[model samples]
Target chain A: MKPPVISAFEPPRRILMGPGPSDVYPQVLSAQAKPTVGHLDPLFIGMMDELKQLLQYAFQTRNEMTLAVSAPGSAGMETCFVNLLQPGDTVVVCRNGVFGERMRQNVERCGGQAVLVDNAWGEPVDPQKVEETLKTNPQARFLAFVHAETSTGALSDAATLCALARKYGCLSIVDAVTSLGGVELKVDEWGIDAIYSGSQKCLSCVPGLSPVSFSPAAVERIKQRTRPVQSWFLDQSLVMAYWGGGAKRSYHHTAPVNALYALHESLRVLAQEGLEQSWQRHQEMHQLLKQGLQALGLQFVVAEPYRLPQLNSIYIPSGVDDATVRQQLLRQYNLEIGAGLGDLAGKAWRIGLMGYGARRENIALCIKALEEVLA
Target chain B: MKPPVISAFEPPRRILMGPGPSDVYPQVLSAQAKPTVGHLDPLFIGMMDELKQLLQYAFQTRNEMTLAVSAPGSAGMETCFVNLLQPGDTVVVCRNGVFGERMRQNVERCGGQAVLVDNAWGEPVDPQKVEETLKTNPQARFLAFVHAETSTGALSDAATLCALARKYGCLSIVDAVTSLGGVELKVDEWGIDAIYSGSQKCLSCVPGLSPVSFSPAAVERIKQRTRPVQSWFLDQSLVMAYWGGGAKRSYHHTAPVNALYALHESLRVLAQEGLEQSWQRHQEMHQLLKQGLQALGLQFVVAEPYRLPQLNSIYIPSGVDDATVRQQLLRQYNLEIGAGLGDLAGKAWRIGLMGYGARRENIALCIKALEEVLA
Candidate 1:
């Protein structure tokens, strides 16, 4: 048989300000295109060390077990749950949106019980309710919640929740997927045990890596687990042998070399901007977007106190078709805004100001394009 | 506290011929650096359609469920098990190397009962033993095994195992992580119900993606399940809403847009090479490496009849320290080869000749480096 011919792949260029996959910085793109190196090469180890250091700075934790997980944010979530909770362990998980529901699933699959603390979509996980749940489930091993709920543009109070977990003698597993660079997340000060964040959200890297940190208590649980971790790939114990501090890196599955290169460069950019500056930039852009949306007579889906600056969720104006407006925005304006998911679908739109997307120019352009579409 | 300073990153060149993450093609590298786009953009949807078609060709399967899982190969494994087996389903899993052990873990984690068929490390799974286990565990719903054991460089008879599954009226889940683009993998012809392979292996794309395909039977099982998939991210039913057939795409999590671009380009490269031609090249390179290793007095760890041509596992010479030799190979020649894993660690070395690494030059260089290290 003759070989199949490959057609040219030319991706249409567009400004990304969606819930995730925020734009890529030029230098990060270049870094992604760098020559491939063996995962265990000496210089690659040096690069790993540098990556770990940068992640520490970004996460604001001295947790020695910090590194990029080989997969996406979902995989990072799975890693935390699988490594920490053994079969039959009870966990207090707060659910306000999509990610919280995912945590419940991870808990169940790990053979652990999820004592779900429910809240309305687009609302923050109430720390009072979380505390009540922990009291109810006195033997719970951990409390898992999303600091920034990407599906609904709601930001939970991470420090308060971590404190609640601490009071109950439970570990805290925080999902910082959309909050890492866009908000203040101090893993050490907040007493977060395990936190996982996505690179594409505000780090401006391509979406393949998830930077994660595990506090000593979480690592202790992994080490003390009775059964071996169910998933070998996500097992923290074995993965640490390969990704942990050392020149003699053991073989895990081949590390995603080029993707890590992109992440390394992305973290470099965050370091240059400084986390506080990046967080402030996201907030500033959100303000600009909020003003524009209010001018157009749109209301925010999340309350002001709980709204995430990086992810702006708003109600679709009356008399406008949801799908049609988003489609037109993409086709004519070359702009992408996320549609609401689950209960909010068809009623709201999620306009993201995150990472490279959280820029003054992008906010103005999105507002202009949205206004034109709505008109 | 002062944030870490951002330093310019420049990747050094090296030859990666270890178990996986072989030298990436320049085009694939550049593809990863392409501009980001929304996961649900019309153009990206079109590209995703093309990617599914390309994956179908690569896997030699007509399964419409062919697509890349958003996470890495481990997540891909989870997707297969979670979709096919409901809780308490009996599964017969064969374990000869590390990946096989991983499959067993996935089976157990998914609430499936795992009836393990154990084989020694660096040995191919014996079909007779698998048949015997199936006879003993007559209630087994599926048979799972690795096609190319990355850890031990052993090649099992996927065709025979799949045929056995058919004969016994059971489904088959095959792990073709190191075999897909480097060896013969006929999913349709072999009657494989579900299969998952890694991008960083023979495909030579950046990691963080797992290309997976499911036959009609597997899809039916997924649809008929009494319980919802425990993993929302990996639930094929929900994922299908996003990656399945239709002009209208649904939203799941954000797609790793640039990573898909790289994967599509790598598949195109594989198609251009022609599957048969690529398989032949792997064989030829293996022949060269075998001759050189024999000359260097290195004996094969796996039997000749069952050895994987792409992953060459050979016993380390007595008195030569495994770590020192591997380090020297990396430091002096800038060549990377894998040390043995699992039970074979410190006893053997695995020299991979996969995809771009399956060249005469790389084989000769690896041999020369080995000879020098031994001297």
Candidate 2:
């Protein structure tokens, strides 16, 4: 067979201000393209140590168990749920949008009961409602919620929720997939037990790696698991051996070396820019985007205080067609923005100002493109 | 915080003849380092479509549901088992090595009962035993086994196994992780239902992705699933949305774009080399390595006819310490060979000849190194 002649992969020059992945830095991309070192190589082990440190900084935790799960954000979610919860465990899941609902599904699949705290589609989880649910369901083992809900651009108060979980004697598993570098996630300060984040979101790395951290308490729970983690791949203890220190490491699945290189470079960039600066950059650009959308008579679906600055869920203009606008952006502007998901479908558009894409130029460009399309 | 400085990632030149991730091609590494585009970008969707087609060609199947799962080989195993087997489902699993035991665990985790057919650690799974197990457990929904047992460097007869599964009205879920590009796999011709392969093994891509294909029957099983797949990340139906056709792709988790780039390029290189040529290269190199090892008085752990040419499991030389030999190989020769796994540990050394690592030069070098160390 003639080698399937591929048209040279000439990626369009677009500012990726979508849900994810935000535009990766040139240095990070170059890092990804680097020669792959052996996963168990001594130099690679050093790199892993650096990566674990970077992840700890990004997640704002001193937890020694911080590492990148070798999969996407959803698999990161799976890693946390599968490792911590077991058959007959009761988890209080906050469902305001798509990711929260995903948590509910994960809980049920783990043979755990989900005591759902329902909220409106684009609204943040109400802590009072969660407290009431947790109090009523005293058996709840964990309080699971997305810190920055990607689908709806809603930001729940993670610290408050974690405190509530502690008050109820439940561990807190936070999903910071969208909030890792873009928002304030004080994992240690908040007393979060387990938290998972994505590389592609605010980190602006490539898409396959997910940075996860487990507090010592969460690690203790995993150590005390009655059942052998059902999924061999996501088992925390086995994974720790590969990522752990020492001359002799236990063998696990092959590590994604190149992806880790990219992630390491990305986290390096984050450290250089300063986490607070990155968060400020996201917020400022989001403000610029909000002003531009307002100039076009568009309104945000999420209320002011609770909305995630990185992901702005704005209502589609009355005369504008959602798919057509996205099509025009792709065809003419060569820009990619996300459409609203689930209940928000057709009614909203998710304009993301995340990481590298969280810039004045991208916001300005998106506004100009939207104006042309809406015209 | 000080910028997370990495001591420039310098990959030392090494001949990786181990179970996996065998030396990745320069082009594949470069591809992985490419700039990450958005997962849902038009350019990316085009790539995803191309990837699906490439996977179809690699698996030798016209199954529409062919794509890379965004995790390592173990997750690929979980995806197949969790999707195909529901609660109370009966599965006949053949356990000759570590990966086979993993399959049995997956079956049990999915609430499926596994009828295990056990064989010696360093031997191919006996088809007659599998047939007997299936006959005894006639209600088996699927027959699960490893095509390439990495732990033992043994290759089971996939064609015969699939035929037996068909005879018993059971679907076949084959672990082709180490066999896909290094050897021959005919998913359609052999009547396999679901198959999973790792990119790191012979595909010579980075480790994050698992290329998988599901036959129409397997797809049907998933569609008619009585209970939701226990894994939210590995759920095929939801995955299909992101990987599926034309203008209307579903919002799955963010893709690992750069890693997929590496996989697509690796597959492209495989196509360029011709699959038959790649398999031949592995075999020829294996022949050279086998002759050299035999000359050095090393004994093979597996029977010649049933051995996987890519992965050669040899008994550790008498009184030649396993740890010392492997460490010396790594430190001195910069060569990384695998230590024996599971029950075979301390007794065997698995030297691999796979993908870019499979060359007469590497074989000659490995033999020379082993001779010097053993002497």
Candidate 3:
């Protein structure tokens, strides 16, 4: 068979207001286009060291085990689960949305038992239920939850949950994929044992790498594990040898060199804006969008306090077809918004106010596009 | 403590001739800087469909399961292992070099037994030995081996291996990380059940994506598996829903959108050049490099017939210090070549002529630089 003649792909310009891959900063995208370099080059290694420090700042933690996992956020979540939990171990996993259910899947696949603490789709994980589950399954080694559930736009109280886990002598594994930069998350202050986040969501970087950090206690648990990590690619112990501090680095899989360049630039942008200021920008944009959405008679699926500012889930207006509205918005306005996932599918639309996407212009564009599509 | 200040990262330009991540084409790099789009966008999904077709052309297969795994080659290797093999199943793994050893690790981690067919470090897997092993271990469900061992610069007989696997009623899982575009690999004709390759190597794209293909037989095995795949992220069964045919793509994970752009551009370049021409160019460059290295008293580690054209592993002179010579080459000439791995460490240097790096000029420059550094 003759090889298909594929021409150069030129992707269309998009106003990304979706759950992730929120419009990457031009500077970050250019960083990705920079000349490729050997992963083990001394200059590259020096940059890697700086990248770790920058990641530390973005994660709001000075944990020594901070580095970007070479894969996506989902792999980062697996890294935390695979490294900490061994076979026959039990974890109290709080399931509130899509990501939380994914956490349960990880637990079961790792040969560990997941004692699920369930909550409503658009509600924060019930702290009372978590406490009761932990009290009952006292042998549980970890308490896992998603801080900001992207699917439902619900933000759980990570601080209270971590405190509960600590009180119950269980390590906390937090999924901060959607919360890393758009929201306020102090990994150190909140005492998150292990946390994984996406570079695309709130970091305004290209989608590929996952920034992960481990508290010292979490590192200790990994060191104390009797069995080897199930997934070698996501194994922190081996990966650390490559990303670890020193002049000498071991050969793990080739670090995604160009992607790291983009991550560094994105994190540098985050540092310049300051974490608190970035959080404020997301919240401010969310308020602007929320007001516009409310004017259109759209009700938010997640309650006000529990809602994630970065990801706003709103009910699809009556008489509006979900796919039709989304398609029309894309075709006419070149704008994109996320459709609801899981149980909320077809019932809601998720409008994101993430890092670089959190601008007054984007808020206006999204609202105006929705209005036109609805009409 | 305040966040450490990180300035913009400017990577130094160098001619990459390493074992992998060879010189990426300028067009491919520019493609990576393209505007980021939503992973699930209709336009982006259209690009993904074209990408699958391009991958099919590169792999020389008509399998509909061809797609790019979001992570690097190691994850791709894991994807093949975790999806096909179950607990207590037996796999005949050919261990000749570093990647072969990695395959054993994957097998063991998946709760499967790996029966080893060991060969010398710089030699290809002996087909006779493999047949003996498979015949004795009749219960073995799979035959796993690396087609091109990056560590040793040895090219195994993939056609023979695949045939033997079929003769024994076992599926074949081939690692073509370093072989794909640089060598003659007819996935359909050779009857390879499953195969994985890296974008960084012969494809001349940036690192962080793995192009994989599965024959109908391998897909059948995945579908018939009694247990859920161990990894949620690397599970091909779940990932197929997103990368499979049609317009509506399920949200599995946020793909590396810009990186996929790079891969598409690289694959287009490959198709334009044609696979046979790419293979011939690698071989011709290898011949040029061979003459120059022979004059410098360098001996190849692998035998003439078994040696990979793209990755040429040569022994260091008895009196020369490996690190000093490589460092001098880097510092003085701005060139990157690979150090030996595993058993060949400190004794061999892997000079790659992969993809865009396979040029008469690159071969000439590498030879001249080595001569100057040695003097």
Best by lDDT: 3
In the order shown, the chain A TM-scores of the predictions are 0.98, 0.98, 0.99
Give, for candidate 3 chain B, the lowest lDDT window spanning 10 residues: B1-10
Error (Å) of candidate 2 at residue B211 is 1.2
Indicate the DockQ of the complex predicted as candidate 1: 0.53
Give the Cα-based TM-score of candidate 2 against the true structure.
0.96
Candidate numbers sorted by DockQ from highest down: 3, 2, 1
Give me the candidate number with maximum TM-score.
Answer: 3
Instruction: Determine the iRMS, in angstroms, of model 1.
Output: 2.2
lDDT of 3 by residue, B1-375 (tens): 476888899988889999978999999999999999888887888899999989999999999899999999999999999999999999999999999999999999999999999999999999999999999999999999999999999999999999999999999999999999999999999999999999999999999999999999999999999999999999997898899946877989999999999999999999899998999999998999999999988899999999999999999999999999889888888899999999999999999999999999898899999988888
The alpha-carbon deviation from the true structure for residue A371 of candidate 1, after best TM-score superposition, in angstroms, is 3.2
| lDDT of candidate 1 over A1-375, digit per residue (tens) | 334566858887788877878888988888988988877777777888899989999999999999998878887898898889888999998999988998998899788999999999999999888988998889998999999999999999999999999999999999999999999989999999999998888898988688999999898888888887767677788788998849767776667877888889888888888989999988988898999999999999999998999999999888889999988888887788888988888999988888888888898899899878887
Error of 3 at A210 (Å): 0.8
Q: Name the TM-score of candidate 3.
A: 0.99
Winner on TM-score between 1 and 2 is: 2
Error of 1 at B217 (Å): 2.3
Ranking by TM-score: 3, 2, 1
Interface RMSD, per-candidate values to 1 decimal: 2.2, 2.3, 0.9
